[model samples]
Target chain A: MNPAFENITSLRAKLAARDITPTEVIEALRARCTQVEPSVSAFNHLDWDTALREAATADASLPLGGVPIAIKDVIAVKGQPCTCSSKILKGHTAVYDAGVIERLRSLGAVPVGRCNMDEFAMGSSTENSADGPTRNPWDTSRIPGGSSGGSAACVAAHEAIASLGSDTGGSIRQPAALCGCVGLKPTYGRVSRYGLVAFASSLDQIGPFTKTVRDAATLLGAISGRDPRDCTSLDQPVPDYTASLEQGVKGLRIGVPKEYFIEGMDKDVEQTTRQALDQLAKLGAELVDISLPHTNYALSSYYIIAPAEASANLARFDGVRYGARVPDGKDVLDVYSRTRALGFGNEVKRRIILGTYVLSSGYYDAYYLRAQKVRTLIRKDFEEAWKKCDIIATPTTPTPAFKLGEKTGDPIQMYLSDVFTIAVNMAGLCGLSLPCGFVQRDSTDLPLGLQFIGKAFDEATLLRASHAYEQSTEWHTRRPVL
Target chain B: MNVEYVAKLARIDLSAQEIETYQNQLGSVLEHMDAIASLNLDGIEPTAHASPVFNVLRKDEIKPSLPVEDALSNAPKKANDLILMPKIVE
Candidate 1:
């Protein structure tokens, strides 16, 4: 088997047996990248020399030792250009490692490449990337979901063994589902966000994209824990996520939210999702019909709350600081305005404006504040649902990956793409998307993702259920023909 | 609804075409927000953050800070250990 296609767990076993060295793995992946990366457009920047150098000295005994992990461009990796796939930070290299990178490095993982993403992680489709949209590996004509599209695509296409992607309103899970891989968005505060470029501070959490559920658990365990640098990181103890992988979902109640299977959703997606639930039931898991009454309001609340926070978080990108600065203005205000005008893409500007407007005078009470209150209701809905079920299962996306340029002209349509996944972020819970099945579109097999949401800080159960379902099915074994 | 005003508040200079485009797009996006606007959230407390964290304090001690050069490495314009911005006190 190609080392590039091998999951991290198997690679670890191989490395332990001395069947292959870390240097050989990097060399194999680099060769695979050379062959497939052009078609995938998954990476914004790749440094084989640096990755190889790290691999040569890697201690294979460490948990993630010598594993080449792709990093989404949003996270800071020392000496790497953490552009967030935007023109604003085109030449800005990270001066220090992000909190997750530091953790991964300490676990002996090699940070190999910078993956492409939405500019400032503002869009659902990776099409908003300044570098260009990362095409779905399954069908080059379709979009790989964003803002972690590159991270998901690279893993699916075997360009990287595993990659880290942040989830802010489904950036990680949605893309992972569309790309046919395992994507986990740990609960809010489960992973430190110190080095992650802020999009929505309250909603953002970094997790992993891997080829299997066990790999996801390994990566999540390595990167998760409290960090003094980020106070939002929970002080809760980090559990061994892999320890519970074999625990079958024999009596676990999986909540099926009626709102998630709504009218107008693609019939194929619903059928595939229902079939996956049936498979889980056959495996002895109970599918309880549940209602998250406030689900309808999650998208509206997220749009307001995320942008309001984004406008504030993004205010730091002025002319004098790090990143590209246009020097046309005579004064500070002119420079700030002119630099931003030329730097940001259309979607970014729209979000910034919407964010500013919502947080601005007169509109705050009506928009931002109201959205936050509605957020409280959304969180309460989850709290109530958890009483009836241990985990919530739903379609990761309403439909399979859509063709490129299909929704670019329509922003609302792009926003609607993340309808099923956004509520998980709003409630600040742990959500995992693994390959459940496939939908044939235009005679091509497009993958469908089944999302399993666990309560806040309850990733162990989430992984347990996901692993149970994944091992029972052949979907996770199926790879896109790149 | 004023696209230019919001752009000004955001410190971005939108082109006439962009302003026109955003005016229509923002209007429609906000129309979607009406879903939450009509909800009865009178007694619900607004959640500023999902994680229940307050002002996190640590022992007051000087820690190693980023070296000046590394801090200023990405600065657009720098002079003698200070980031040089446009003259503010003109």
Candidate 2:
């Protein structure tokens, strides 16, 4: 195996056998970081000295000891600048570690640095990133999809063994799909959201971006379970995600939602996904065609509801609190106005205004309330479909990533990219995206992601299906020729 | 809504460039949202949060506070461990 291409499982075994020291692994990672990071733009922050120190102290017996992991900038890691890649939050340092960060540290997983992302996790492509765009490691001109673009890129480029990423709509999984990595978004409350900066509070959940499905689960096993600080977190027992990986899908029922194969989907993506389904059928899992009829309005309903919630949640970022504060002028309003005016990016401002408009007096019931009702109908559609199958599978993204500046000028076109994934969030379900295949498009090299969504709190089913798919294919093993 | 109507209602004086962009973007976005407006959601209880969380019970205990200096340490301009802001009022 190439020294730079070790997955979390292989890295753990090497650490146990003393074939690689924590210091050497960090050196290899730092070396890889130096080589590919400039073109990749995978990180917003780097602190090698701190990572080395932590790695040096990793317990010799822990499962993930000494594996360097990257954290999305939206997440807090005590004493680091958790900017969420926005100029407004520039120079703001966190006073505390996020819950997931603490858990990774407790397991001897060294947090290498903060990865880049869309400002406030607002955009689909990291092009909206204030830190500048995170390019596809496979093709520097194309996008590494956002809001967890940096995390996916870093994991894909082998900068870190795995990384932490937040998904509100398709943020984590979308980027993972584009970058050819595995990303999982747990059920709404499966992972703690206490320390995560809220984008759309109701839709946001944090999970992993890894090179393999099992690693995504292993990393999840470490950070999941109930936390007293976040009341919204499900108070359910945490299961060993890796232990259930071998639970064969011999008798599993997989539903391929026909609605996802809508018109205008890229021909290559459609063909590749169809090929994957045939393989799954040969693996003994029955494939059934299903429908998500309310899907047509999913994007419309989610846009209103997510932005409305985001508008309310982000209200706490005023200068009175710990975020970037504008210089105080005569009154409080001046401080707030100037701070927000200078701090927020155009996309964030756009969403905030859109959210504010939809939630205003006369528009409240007409826009926000109706979107809520549609959200229910969308969820009900899923509940009805689940009774016929064990899991739903589709292409994680409708198209392979476009050029960085391709859709930046059009926000609606950008929102359309989340079409296949956002409804899953609106329905409060769990989903995982893994690299099922790759395609050559637009003379640029980027991978299309195959997304498998499980019923609410049915992460095991998604993982089992994805693992079975991966175990039988070599797509997960391909690497960028950096 | 007219450009000025929204600008005043939102409490921000948007630049001419911003107004042009908003006029186009907001108009289209809202038009797309029109689909939901026509849905008959009669007698539907609006769902607030996707997850379940009950009345939170917290121990009403106080702990030592971060020194005033530490709390205000990141403030760009401060006085006596307090965050300093620009003067208020128009």
Q: Which of the numbered candidates is closest to the native, going by highest DockQ?
A: 1
Candidate 2 lDDT over A1-482, as tens digits, reads 55568888888999989888888888888898999998999899999898888878887578788888899999888878888898767888877778888888888888888999999999988877878989888888889998899999999998888999999899999999999999999998899987899988889999999999989889888989888778788888888888899887787899999899978788988998998998899999999889998888889998898888877877766666566765544577666666676677888877877888888889888888898888888888898999899999999998898887998888889998998899889988999999988888766557888899998888887898999999999998888877
Question: Residues B4-74, candidate 2, lDDT per residue (tens digit)?
Answer: 45444444446678878888887888888787776777877666666766686878788775567656766
Clashing pairs in 2: A88-A343, A328-B85, A328-B86, A329-B86, A329-B87, A330-B86, A330-B87, A330-B88, A331-B87, A331-B88
Over the stretch B1-90, how does candidate 1's per-residue lDDT look in tens digits? 899988998999889999999999989999998988678887899988888889999889999988889999999889999988878996
Give residue B89's error in model 1 in angstroms. 2.4
TM-score versus the correct structure, for each prediction: 0.99, 0.96
Which pairs clash in model 1?
none
- Candidate with top TM-score is 1
Query: Which stretches in model 2 have alpha-carbon errors above 4 Å?
Result: A1-3, A323-328, B2-13, B63-70, B87-90
